[model samples]
Target: MTTTTSSLLNIRPNFFYDKVINWFPGHMAKGLRIISEKMSSIDVIVEARDARIPISSINKKFEEVANVKERIIVYNKCDLAEESSQDIITKAFEKYRNQKVLFTNANMDRNIKTIINIAANKARENPQKYPFVTVMVVGMPNVGKSSIINSMRRLGVHRGKAARTGANPGITRAVSNTTIKVLENPTVYLIDTPGVMIPHIPDPVCSLKVALTGGIMDHLSDEEVIADYLLWRLNNFSNFGYVEKFKLPGPTDDVNVLLPAVSKRIGALHKQGCLRLSGT
Candidate 1:
């Protein structure tokens, strides 16, 4: 639970870390523009975020574009986060009484129905005016947006995955041409949009959290920096799960000391027998 950085000693500054301040690419801009254009048709905006890094995963730009629509903040991948922390995360958003926050595990179909019901209920507030509910699903990359859409389709229509799901980020590149129908009674359609990031992530730590959680592309950030940050995070909470997982001699704060040991323990070596610290 500690946030001290004294453990990270003598680490050289990285170029990628410095440049990641303005990591926004052109595609993100285009995606934002597309979302803005479709705001007129969207009845509800489902903002998906990683349950582990809820605060950092949120795209601040969505607030400006989706402020008018009914926003449902879904903290996806709840199964991966600590169950005890859910209430704490929920309470953090209590101020947003206008917005509804739901923790969901899309892969397991948990809370899928509730999310649909909430969106439907919100849209039905003006049933005659808004007959068809058009829900726009937005979130950072690799946060299970497509998985949630697919789950909704499975429950609403008993159909298989309509939106493609992947383990990495940026799978949904842009808004799809075809609409995915999630419910039949009230006729709910979901518009799957690409995972868009803010134009600039001013805080480096926030950027690292996003990178470590796979919100941003892996190649965009150096592997070692991300791994190191992960190590620091694990050590901060005194979570030595990695020590057992990697079969290390003991828990160490220094990634330099840890990575080599991990590389050796796991036999992660090059063809020439050199230890692959980066690979580890």
Candidate 2:
């Protein structure tokens, strides 16, 4: 909670804020190593990503692992992101002819079924010439991998009855193996890996918003300007209407007019006489 001001930028800085910016811990390095070691045994890789930020959620390093096996991209939380954004994302991935892309709300039963069907198709089309097919579920924390597995089990697609599911994020922390019989064609095996936040080229502004809105930022940043930038983006982006409903102040064409407008809306008043528009 200690706040420090940066003389260079005239911005307040805090150690807690630094922690938020650096939330992706070093443990991911070990996770990547483990995934690399297990790639040989995996037949098809199922990657789950937030539909809101599909491109950002994906780890570029996945290309390295995917080169060894078939990759199926699952766009989870499709219900959250804007429809137009989702369409753009689907088209963007269409160039990867080798990969199969699927959009679904992993929390729902039908979408989970669709995912299973697509995965089965990907496994059957595998050119590796392997006798048995294996699919590994991967994604960032809270992307709904476990929930999807549980839904598959409910539909009787997954054979083992002991698999557990939960509502919270980071529920599945270890690799677990399970087997299922796919309607008399062949026996399918699945490997579930621990969800790790994929590291990417950081955009401090966008990352801050994603982390804060999704509860991913455990430590709050001390830089209010960063938050201001986020508010500005949210206000400008018509898709993020919820932000305006929160009555947050946002920048406009003219700082003078915009400041007073936002200050009144956010209830920031000056102690002496006028409204304190500086912070807004």
Candidate 3:
């Protein structure tokens, strides 16, 4: 738990901090190439980004490939974030990408209506003679690309779970072979593409946020490191929910001390000398 604002800004450690994290897999590169090649067919690119770390979650590969197309930024997980923060995110992302931004909650049915409305509105801008409207949902992994599709289906036509949902990132390894119909009033179809990540996460802050938000695979990150980062964030905001949730002795910055307590409380290690969750 940091006490001041300067500590929040300076996430880079004095030593022992790696500037970059390698989260890109071979599948991601393939996915990026596929999205780049297929960009011509998409009428609208609905880029889903996490609300908590708006600035950090943008996948640059999507920008390089889909910049020419009409983009709608979907700030997913609005329920997890504060209202004021969501407003700030909507504005910052709108200005940064020069695209329309809509805050959405994919798990619940709320705010799902605006997605197709925006897509239909974008489709109308072109005035094509096509019979159906095609929308491609894309973003970093586990950012609700699939969940968004299912939510639209549930909202628009009373369908259920059109796409898979999970806790881990990179669940959707590639683009779907066929489009899922989410709306019928204007007849909109959505293409749920695999969430793509930049090849190298150069900014430590961005990588931390991505990992914290489940955009990157946990195996690639040290769990203790991620835990410490989360602790710092909760402390920065004066959030002591962990104290009650984990039964801690107040709050602590050292994940070294925190994890053993947590591990013991959760019955993770029965005969531990010093707890090592990495299994090294």
- Residue-wise lDDT of candidate 3 within 61-110, one digit each (tens)? 77787789878888889889887997676567568766688888888866
Backbone clash tally (model 2): 2
- Estimate every model's Cα lDDT from 0 to 1: 0.81, 0.59, 0.78
Task: Tell me the TM-score of model 3.
Answer: 0.87
Q: What order do you get sorting by lDDT, best first? A: 1, 3, 2
The candidate maximizing lDDT is 1
**TM-score attained by model 1:** 0.87
In the range 106-190, model 2's lDDT, one tens digit per residue, is 5566466665565566447763564566777777766777666666555545444334555444555566644544323444566
Q: Which ranges of candidate 3 are over 4 A from the true structure?
A: 1-16, 93-98, 122-128, 271-280
* Number of the candidate with higher lDDT, 2 or 3: 3
TM-score per prediction, in order, is: 0.87, 0.66, 0.87
Candidate 1: give the clashing pairs: none
Residue 89 in model 2: lDDT: 69
